[model samples]
Target: MGQGRGAVMAELMFWEAVRRAHDEELSNDPMVLVMGEDVGVVGGTYKATLGLYDKYGEDRVIDTPISENGFTGLGIGASFIGARPIIEIMSVNFAWLAMDQIFNTAAKVRYMSGGQLEAPVVIRSPGGTAHQLGSQHSARMEKVFMGIAGLRVVTPSNPRQAYGLLKSAVRCNDPVFINEHELMYNMKGEVPEEDYFHPLEGSEIVRPGRDVTLFGYNISVHWCLQAAELLSRHHGIEAEVIDLYALSPLDRSGIRDSVTRTHRAVIVEEAEPMVGVGAEVMAIINEECFYELDAAPVRVSALNVPIPYNHSLEKTALPDANDVVEAVRSMFGV
Candidate 1:
């Protein structure tokens, strides 16, 4: 237990892992470069690229003008010309400005060109809410990209997984959408001192149990863990928790395994219940784990209404630990 605790504590912060990934990739491949607003001087809106400018110099760690479409297109163009560009959109909400370049060019290029060209680009963005940031900034747009066939979407829930998955995304041949939860930047966890890469399509069971399966990703995963603790101590229920880090490449095996073992599932998401990732997970469970399930799968998600500015209402709107606990209890009729 002591060793395990120490190992967990040794992990790097999510932002720090991202910075290290960029540094290592930039060093290994001269074609790899970073460009975005404040990435060079301000070290990015979330400081994910801090000190990169000093090491790589201005040419590689570029600070572009406030133009998402222009820089995104420029990155895609560079990729076509043998340069691997890491484009940082300040926030996923801002990605809308570059939709044409992303969906039309980056996503379609390889398929349209019969695999002759690969858009080895990464679009990194800070997404989701940061405590009452309101509707504009808090949207989870992973589902929007789910419809696009060629894009790879990844969202790591913790520091260690964040580092591993981001490294893999950087090296992949396709365009990768790496969504960093705004509230998870400062979170710390044990990442191996040596470099590592998590498979793009794999999901990990963060906690093991037999009573129920609690599925989530990003910040919601943390809440699931909290609810798991409460369920174990207060309700005497052991809830298995699975983090579906990569949203687009759904880890059906992990979801199926957990549901088969527990025979009950409760998916928690910070996004809306309607058309959110939770809905997709629930559907997948219904198809894959329907016979194994002892009770109907459930989803605990944010309210469909626009996020309120009021703190109390905002707290009520998003899925909380209690929501997860109640879902688990309700699923088992306990």
Candidate 2:
């Protein structure tokens, strides 16, 4: 909110915020180090861990081989022994190879050990359909990771959260999964230069409105904001937008309060409709504010089909601002 690096609020690309987070954490904590494929010499697939290789050297900024499962297991093992490991899978598509370690080990170790073990590790991967990345490469694994029992899940919509949330995740003792959007690497947003850390749990009301609430996180959060502006300017419908950043330890109170006040909601997600954050938010609305609701909650989500490689087909597969606006308009019959 204030000045960054002696400048009047630093404007940074999403990857820069990510890189800053990794840089800060690695510098601040002796035990904090990075491990993943090409995270060393090549500077990560998305460059989210750039320069750390040079700054921290080989031991701290580790470069793992091609085995996702092996390195993921190694990272979790490192965390178990008190070293905070930040494992970056080049893509969520590749993370499937490490599911056994993520779900059975990292997510369950603390519980399985009866609190004797703390898997204080953070696994980050960029997911969702990005341009022509095919179905196999474009899986939004948030639904899968968020559903796990003992994991904390979060997705940041902008640079500030990317910086702040990663800092928080590093300090937290629980196993955390950060799902960054594949297409949001270059999206620019402001980040204060001051040392700031956003909470691991909670949602922020990005825009205040009276008509209906629009909910999203990561890239979908931008879609909600864009739709909210259109609804306000063209249709006179003021739509409140909520950034549901913490997907696992969901901010139920925030969701309840906004849905209670607005009485209608439209959830925008890049993931499929079935068993998603949309469905969970809708369930919460039905349970907490059923009588307050004037209309059924609507979910504007990607099609159930696998993400097509064709650009046009991919566009059709994902939800957009127009879909959100139309969904909100339908609630009020406007």
Candidate 3:
């Protein structure tokens, strides 16, 4: 119905969409290239770049040394002079090493240079807890990236979003950070048979309802959807689920419209509660829809602690569908 795909086809996995998008873009442009550790021969730690090395050759599909700041800065420099480079920082935790390049150089270059130059680069990395990675490895750093002044941060919830958003990011004139989830690579969803590029701004309503509105991005979007179903079947509460694919330049109006109709809001996030996405959404609601709300907005977020290596403790640290259901129930005193 909407733009992007010309036809509908079989379900595609998250990584499959990523792979296809890389193949398509690399084949379409000579200036486009991929640079990351293990991306060339090993085909990426998550196999998202499988077969790209053989197809694009050594130059186009480069395997960089184990240096996040060095390779990321190199990619940014390349983008300034008309080259489009997709830099992969194996994990978000490692991305901290490149924070200077990402925040200072890539984000501020255009405005600081008085619009004389732009960094047309895309940084793709997986974040959030997966299995028992724990503590240092389990940071969901989207909030930090979204707070930057001139950067665009996107977190794709499904395969279609993953495919279309990645394509769109490459064409963007400014730097784009794509926060993929480690747990979502094998996730499957329906994608079009043809190429399509999703817009870098705005949000999508995945489910329609008349009661409370649930907002989430990336892995949290699925949790919101599940909560919506539980609310419908168990508590007779119909939650309208919205997927916030675009993290930065958030769709404030879209959230306002949804909350205006539903009259209640529950923001979900996989990250810590303090100064996170949920906090931002709550602030937006308080600012824009304070009069429209029937009660205070609720945030179902991860506990404020290092994600544990123990399986049970790890599960306990994060919010789940049950937590969402309870939060909604508490909103209406049910």
Candidate 4:
């Protein structure tokens, strides 16, 4: 069931990918377990861990109290004792309660111990805006961890990348933060069952073109892909779309290669522009691909404001497919 090329094209939802990754890892490793609020009986808020408690039993699949800080600290302690705990934060909004454990402990334990101990912990959390989930729950906290040192930040855009990256994050010997977009849980795409692992450092080109390079990650990557298709069909401009799976370890090589080929670039991100991930990508392009650029690196991102409750206002605040198309057009003076 885990092999054969035919299994690669089987479409799976994002939550299904998470389920597959956890199930496979748990079955193989005795130390691997999952703990979070309502994860056991309730099958997780997003249903990512559904049916796990039945198969793995209560000891392996645990339901913690509504205490992010306490349970996260417990996970860190367990990791110190050689148990690889998959700590699921109910949402990135709740993760604030566990910042001390995440930043001060999970991120620094191995380095502080001088290679004597390893914290193979994976903290999975749902992040970003979805279905008008208020100001606190709708926030995109990728920048918070991006600033922290000694931690791996990954945000996969599609089911394939999500599955592969989650698998790799589970097997790694360091603290890994896997940010799954709340809106992307039901999004479906093909994932290989042949145990494929994409490196967590580099970027993947989703679409190849010559006119402009569109940089994206997480939900923005799928938006850029749609924008690329629109730009080709409606405006006759070919746009190269790059999905940056790993945000912290930015893929300079992939960005450089794409920018060198396309000469024009536009970075698209769901976060606000002022101090967001797009700003970092723009800086990298300016530093590394400055000579190759034919135009300034344009950034199409959410406006620098809190996401509104009104559907229309929220949609306007976030970068849409049209925003990407316009940004690409503006970059090329078209």
By TM-score, the best candidate is: 3
Error of 1 at 91 (Å): 1.0
Cα TM-score per model: 0.95, 0.97, 0.98, 0.95
Q: What C-alpha lDDT values do all the predictions have?
A: 0.86, 0.91, 0.93, 0.86
List where candidate 4 sits over 4 angstroms from the true fold.
1-7
lDDT per residue (tens digit) for residues 79-145 in model 4: 8888989999989989999999999998888789897877788899999989777678788888788
RMSD of each: 2.9, 2.0, 1.1, 2.0
Find the 10 residues in a row with the least total lDDT in model 2: 1-10
Candidate 2 wrong stretches, greater than 4 Å:
1-8
lDDT of 3 by residue, 242-330 (tens): 99999999999999999999999999999999889989988888888899999899999999999999999999999988899999999
Q: Encode model 2's per-residue lDDT on 112-146: one tens digit a residue.
A: 89999989999999988888888899999898898
Q: Candidate 3 overall Cα lDDT vs. reference?
A: 0.93
Instruction: Supply candidate 4's per-residue lDDT for 197.
Output: 63
Off by over 4 Å in 1: 1-10
* Candidate 3 residue runs with Cα over 4 Å from true position: none
Q: Write the per-residue lDDT of candidate 1 for residues 1-334, one digit (tens) a residue.
A: 1112234345578889888888888998998999999999889888889999999989999999999999999998998878989999999889989989999999999999999988989998888877888888777777777658899888889877777777787788899988789999989877766667777786878999999999988888999999999999998999999988888878888889889999989998888888878889988998888999888889999898888888898888888999999888887677
Q: Using alpha carbons, what is the TM-score of model 1?
A: 0.95
Residue 317 alpha-carbon offset, candidate 4, angstroms: 1.4
Better of 3 and 4 by TM-score: 3
Estimate the TM-score for candidate 3.
0.98
